[model samples]
Target: MLMILLAIASACAYGVADFLGGAATRKAKVFRVVAISAPASLAIEGLLLPVLGARWEAGSLGWGAASGAASAFAFALLYQALSIGPMAVMAPITALVSAALPVVVGLAEGDRLSATEIAGIPVAACAILLVTVKRSAGVGRVRPKAVAVAVLAGAAIATQLIMLNQAPHDSGVAPLIVGRAVSSLIVLNAAIAVRRRIDPGRPNLGLAAGAGCLDSLANLCFLLSARHGLLSVSAVIVALYPAATIVLARAVLKERISRAQWLGLGMAALGVTLLALG
Candidate 1:
């Protein structure tokens, strides 16, 4: 139960970071944002190492690094998708794909859920879909490219979850920190090769860096939760991040949300509650 709560908190933190990251990307190059943000995150997480006193193991370090690489890919794709497309179509799709993957993996591993939890899945799905709906459009209309990128992002996200879950439980947060650092370096190098320049003068560097710090914290919480709970349940709870993003959009961006989104938010909350109970 405690783990589940931690997972929910992770989701909240991730959602906020995502929202801020996305917003930051709007005014800056995606690669630049990533390059600056990654180091910023590493610094923040490094500071927490002593306080958290997490164990360190070679295997866990490798897995954490792998997860970090996957996360870098996911965020890069997500930022690219949002750069050219509508958030209403892309965000929810990515979130759903990422959330569903761990559940599928858990099912394959024979993890069973209670009746209430089973019922909550579709409700949560529907709610997520509803929240993605923009006030400008009615049901059944979405941009295809945005959807594609979102799906790819989700796949990367799922990979992160799977790798993180596979890491040795006793291995402290070092693995995570190392993983993130390696992933960031990989993405940074890739971005440099592609763009031929590393420009850190992006308008929202501070915001992106701040978001990265939150993201690092979220990852720490998630790793802790995964160590203590069912992977599927923990993943689903953490996936409720879209709810936080939607709320942030409405509040910070002053974007008008539709009635359906509100209803979806309610359903998502209910689904998360059921998941917790299970």
Candidate 2:
């Protein structure tokens, strides 16, 4: 139950952060947005280090770094896909792929689910699809390239979860923090090399910083949850972050939510409740 709660909390935090990050990308360069966000994340993690305490082994460090790099790559690809693809198609597909990978891995690792959870999987997938579904009057459809990138991003996310699962149980949040910092640096450098620009600007700087801080905090919570519970279950619960994003988009972006999405949100909630109980 505690793990499920932590995962929910992490999902909320991540949803907000991702929304902010996506918003920032509209006004700033993708690389710049990520670069600024990365340092902000590092700062937040740095402050939390005292509270979380440092407990890391060499193995944990390696795995954490690997996770970070994979995440950075995922982010890059996702941004590229978003630039060229429809959000309605790309976001949900990527999210579903990301969510599915850990569940599959967990099943492979002999993690058993209750009958309720077993049913919840398809429901959750449907919910994810509903949340991302957009009603277009015109003839805009999903791009194949965007789908490919989203799939890759999902694979990267799954890899991150798997690596984190392999991290030392007693390593505290140090390995996670270290991994995030390294990943941020790598992303920052890549952005610099590719764009040859580093403009933080005025308002966007603050937004990026805030997004990074929230993201880092969310990552911390996710690591803590994974350490305390089954990785597959934790991943599934945390993967529900997109639900929050959908709700926020409706409220903030004035986007219309379909009847299906409302139904999806309700189903996702029920599924999560069953997961928690399980």
lDDT of 2 at 175: 71
Over 4 Å off in model 1, which ranges?
80-86, 135-149, 196-201
Models 1 onward score TM values of 0.88, 0.91
Q: Pick by TM-score: which candidate is best? A: 2
Which digits, one per residue and each the tens of the lDDT, describe model 2 over residues 1-278?
78888888888898899889878878877677777888889888888878778767788789888988888888877777777887677777788888888888888888878887787677777777776677666527766777898888778887877787777877777777878877888887787687746565533887788899999878877877877777777787777787788788889999777897888789788878777777
Candidate 2 stretches greater than 4 Å from native:
137-143, 197-203
Query: Model 2: how far is 24 from its true place, Å?
Result: 2.3
What TM-score quantifies how close candidate 1 is to the native fold?
0.88
Enumerate residue pairs that collide in model 2: 55-171
* Best-fitting candidate, scored by lDDT: 1
Error of 1 at 220 (Å): 1.3
